[model samples]
Target: MSSRYSFGGDEHVFVEVSEEMSLEAFFKALSMTNAVRDAEISGVTEICPANASFQIKFDPDVIRPDDLLTELRRLEDIADRAEATLDTRIVEIPVYYRDPWTHETLMRFRERHQDPESTDIEFAARINGYSSVDDFIAAHSGAPWFVSMVGFVSGLPFLYQMVDRARQIQVPKYLRPRTDTPRLTVGYGGCFSCIYSVRGAGGYQMFGITPMPIYDPDQETSYLREFMVFFRPGDIVKWRQIDRDEYDGCTADVQAGRYTPRIRDVVFSLEDFNRDIDGTNARLEETLYAD
Candidate 1:
């Protein structure tokens, strides 16, 4: 694939690896950024990997922009030859689909949705060929999604499912943006899924709410003690549907500082996943929830 290189300014180099979002593109970007970080390249201040691209911020005074670009090209070549595997973590995030709060919010914003008469999930289900919202939720929660990027808001993860392109879920954003979104609300727009990191303005079609906080500035819980944000670009997030009782219990645990998200160490191989998507995913799910 041809990659386009451009300068964001004198200190930043942006590289778009692909026009469309794909696991391959994200893996390439992540691998290259990791390699650059490990090399400890002089003057490099930051490396940010996105859905299909990456940007490197550097001190142009110490390393000329042109020289940095050349080094980046060399690193990209090396990354292409490396094994297509990632050492990462799989995190299970609980979600309450059709929760009362989000339902209320959605109802209030019906005029902003494509179908003013139907709920967000109903409209999404109709367009995606699902018979009902229950079927849609089943399909969505059935697969694990990779954290392709963490942006739009700090700790807001843009997720792409591990399934093939044809099986990927897609939804359109609201006809008009909503003035408020509940924190930890799971949303879908375009080909990406995201968890609202904070309660703020959002346009994504809201589906559900997760009780856990993705971006806890206070870092009160064990999981967020070390890092305020729980997700990384390559981490895997599996959304499991929960009942209202379980949701309330989990919320209490979070408030009491007793909730720790289920997480497991894993090595994700792009080659294996591409070869046998279902098998790989089953194995991943097993590994993540194993005792």
Candidate 2:
């Protein structure tokens, strides 16, 4: 079970947990190690019952495979009993997807999907598990949480598992896409779980747009550093919804440069664009939390 951990060409650790192994047990085994040694460990779980496997990756420069192996070997039992803890944080972002113009804008987006339905504010709140937009944003407080494999679009991160209530978002029926949709708009009929970072046509029903810049090329590191979003693997996310005024103000702050682009802190290089996986784009996970 421990033999599957490998290193990429650039020295990134890649470990796969097969169907036979238990994920809970694997994470328990991983938890015995020091947090510092767990540098940049993030990967996805292939949860098919017949083919369950978790792919883990880490920075090789900070940790050696031999050291990792040794640590795992020596502390395997301890790890198996320890709990994996995630460091979570909350970020407040203001966005304006609820503008009155959204009705028309959404209509345009709906044209791309067959029988695309209009969404009411109450429905949006319900899907996000909030009674109101204010309540929605307020609940999304704490450390930034990252989840795996939300669909990606235009180099923007689409995070998942907003909440159990949010998991029921419906897939669009239409097969064709609209090219005129703005990138900042929320797609999938106000699913609010996904976001588009740039201006482009998409098939997902968009609910609104956040004023914040989803990516920055000038920073030393951007959120897209390795195409991951705000949170690392296994982190939890709390989502909230806010009113139009709050969203407008947030955009104003970003436009005025008061709010730094969080994506810049993790993005590595624009030069690496050529090496990025094709069609795997990202959008910043937009939760309407104010603080």
Candidate 3:
């Protein structure tokens, strides 16, 4: 589909690459945004990429709105012709599924769930055609997910799995929003997976908890020293399942200022992934974990 452009008042321009979410659409958005950023377009204050769209904040005084729209159209054409490649990083996120903390929280909010008797994972597993919660967790942690958007909360990443549409896991949010969700809580809603960056009100189905922090105000860790937010749109994330012992160990490491997440720089290609989903994902994980 052709790109659709719209004006957001006089300061922002919104572009929709596709009505639905797909890697191709995201790549297109990323490509166009990167090109505009590289050009150092005058008056462009911020370039934000969403699930399948992007928006640019600018100063109309420095560059006329019509002129900026023309430039964006030009950039969109350039992006269409450019190679389908993304310069991004793969980050390993450790999660302890069905942990006691989140389990208790879910139990307390059971009446707000579709199945008050069953745990969040149990209900999710049953609906997804899995026989047990373990099977559901296995399916979830089996594939890597791409960060399509980072919002709703500071540093919270909305992740879409790098798999065929049929294979994607889908879940519904709580019947009522929870008053409190623990920081680093792993949640799922619709077709996206999310990690809560802070303890706050949430409606997503709570599944697990991560030991490391995704958002730090003080920027204490080495990883957070450069930026308070760890994730950006287009970053690949693999959720690694860990036991309570390992979770505690990682937590201790974080407290001691010694925890560093597993990360690797790799060029993601939409063409290659479209051709071979499993092969591309294997290569991505291997590259990220390689010694």
Candidate 4:
């Protein structure tokens, strides 16, 4: 389907890839936007890729809006004919589930939650048809997730699971936004997962917390030294459940500026993935953990 184009006055143009968010929509938008970037079109100042769409900022004085739209359509046609692959990294993240920090924060915000009586995990497990929280954890940590987009509190990534839609773990956000959320709180809302990069206001249901910092302006930590923002769109992530002891240890390493998240560079083929989801994901796993 062709994209829906809307102009944000004379300076910006928004292209909606699909009415609803899906992997297909994301890929189409990404491919087209990337093509635009590689082409280095004049007057195009910024390209922002979201889950199912992209917005481009441009100077109308250099290129007319209708001309820019025509170029985008032409570029997308070329991009569609090309193979779909991405150079991205697979990262292993350590998550301490059922931690005390998020627990305390949730309790304070009970009135805003769907179930005030149960913890976030318990609520999620119940709604997702898991008999136990342990089973829920197994299901969650069992699969890899794709970083669909990076936004919502700077450097915070929106993750979509690599499983089929029927197998997705879905959860509702809080009834009302919380004034406080622990930094690095692993959260889920609808079908997407996220790690809170900063502590402020949020509505996503908190599941766990990672000791890692996804964003830091100071770049004081070893991991953030390379890039202040740790996550990027198209990055794949695997969750490794950790105990309190391990969490503390990792936190110590982070504070001492000695910790680095385990990462592996991998080329992802969307064609192969769409053809055989399970096989493609398995191959990605092998590439990520190859010894």
Candidate 5:
């Protein structure tokens, strides 16, 4: 697929890799972004890679927009020829599904939801043909997710479920954005599931909350001491369902700076994943637990 590069005013160059979202598109976008970052293009300030696109912020005074675009085209070709693989970390996040925190927040915004009478998960489960909420939760936690983009809010991850397109869970954003969303709220919108890094207005349908601090401003947490943001665009996420008791225990650990997510370094291959999605994921998970 040909990439369309357009200037975002004078400071940013937006490169759209595809008109639609797909693993192929995301991989291409990521590959190109990686290449550009490695090239260390002069005057380039930041490279932001999204699901099916990427953006480069630069100082045009140092590197002309035309010149930058030309360099990007060359890098794009290099990326196209490179092997489609990622050496990234898979992190396990324990979630308390149907937790009281997100439930309270969603109830307050029921009028803004598609079904005022039904809870977010209830509505989602019904429309998605799940026999019950338990079944829906199972489906959600069954597959790993890829961190496609890393900001709707600081440190918030926009995750694409790592499953075949036909098996993806889809949900609509609220009719209107909610004035408030609890921090660490596990929310889903469209084909993405996100962990709300901090409390603020949001439109994603709330499912639950995680006790682990995904975004630590103070870098107080053990895992976050190296980087305030716990997730990156290429990280993998495995969801583990937890009860309220387990959630409370995790909360205590977080308070004591003793909580650390289960993480495993993995080499993900697009070809291998496409060949055996379930087996690949199973091996990855086994490595995580075996550690």
Candidate 6:
């Protein structure tokens, strides 16, 4: 649990915090340490359901590699006394997958071509929710996932492991890999690391997508490489599957921008919708001076 800071490279220093470092404590250390300027924290591999750790990328400009190590050591010295006051948040994301494919049909076809029950392709199709995996994720809207890295093709984010009953299996690419698959959703061979927004010749089997533009150069936050990602190290993610109806609903919501409901909108809607019944406030106000 001691702060063990190691130099991963000339530009990046990796600081592995105690598994139990409260979110507040972790951020406090980062802020207090003169070595760390900015940090982009994200979850890493989930070794087990109970034990997971974060892979934090520290900004090397503010903190010298050696100084970072010293500060982390100092933080660890007070680890016992440090109060736990940090609340971690789970970030949910929606993704979609589509192809002229069905798990059953694919299984039958593969069986006709090869040994069906024994083929990895068939097994992968079944266990990975290949047919509607992306659609399913889409329905949930805000399924929690942590953005790990960005640099594959411009704005491609490398995401942490997925939490689902679907076992993370390594599925091979097509005999001739296609150049259109935007993200390579490989869960098995590479331990389920997903590529964000790019398309090129890839040998990894793709599972799903979010067809929208991922990296926008015009935006102020374009190609963000260093920011606090959605998930931390030990957060648990539950993957809920969405049917076709739910998928359509989400698409409709997105088209009208209903998905991005603002805080003010929520407050107004609640008050207006319930004003007559709740009588908390008058529906409208007009003043007449009786001078």
Number of the top lDDT candidate: 5
List residue ranges in candidate 4 displaced over 4 A. Answer: none
* Cα lDDT listed for each candidate: 0.92, 0.42, 0.92, 0.90, 0.93, 0.36
Tell me the tens digit of each residue's lDDT in model 4 across 144-200.
998888887779999988887888999988999999999999999988999999998
Model 4, residue pairs in steric clash: none
After superposition, the stretches of candidate 1 with alpha carbons farther than 4 Å from their true spots are: none
Give the poorly placed runs of model 6, Cα more than 4 Å off: 1-5, 8-11, 16-65, 76-86, 95-122, 125-180, 183-189, 193-195, 200-204, 210-238, 243-249, 261-291
**TM-score for predicted model 4 compared with the true structure:** 0.96
Cα lDDT for residue 283, candidate 5: 84
Measured by TM-score, the strongest candidate is 5
> What TM-score, over all chains together, does every model reach?
0.98, 0.49, 0.96, 0.96, 0.98, 0.44
Number of backbone-clashing residue pairs for each candidate, in the order shown: 0, 35, 0, 0, 0, 11
lDDT of 1 by residue, 15-40 (tens): 99998989999999999989999999
* Model 6: lowest-lDDT 10 consecutive positions: 282-291
lDDT per residue (tens digit) for residues 1-291 in model 5: 889999999999999999988888999999999999999999999999998999999998999999999999999888888899999999999999999989989999999999999999999999999989999999999889999999977999999988999899999999999999999999999999999999999999999899999888898898889989998999999999999999999999999988878898999999999999999989888877885
> What are the C-alpha RMSDs, in order, of all predicted structures?
1.0, 11.9, 1.4, 1.3, 0.8, 12.8
Return the TM-score for candidate 1, rounded to 2 decimals.
0.98
Query: Candidate 4's error at 127, in angstroms?
Result: 1.1
Error at 222, model 5, angstroms: 1.9
Flag the better candidate by TM-score, 5 or 6: 5
Q: How far is candidate 3 from the true structure (C-alpha RMSD, Å)?
A: 1.4
* Poorly placed runs, candidate 3 (over 4 Å): none
Q: Counting only residues 3 or more apart in sequence or on different chains, how many pairs clash (N, Cα, C under 3 Å) in candidate 5? A: 0
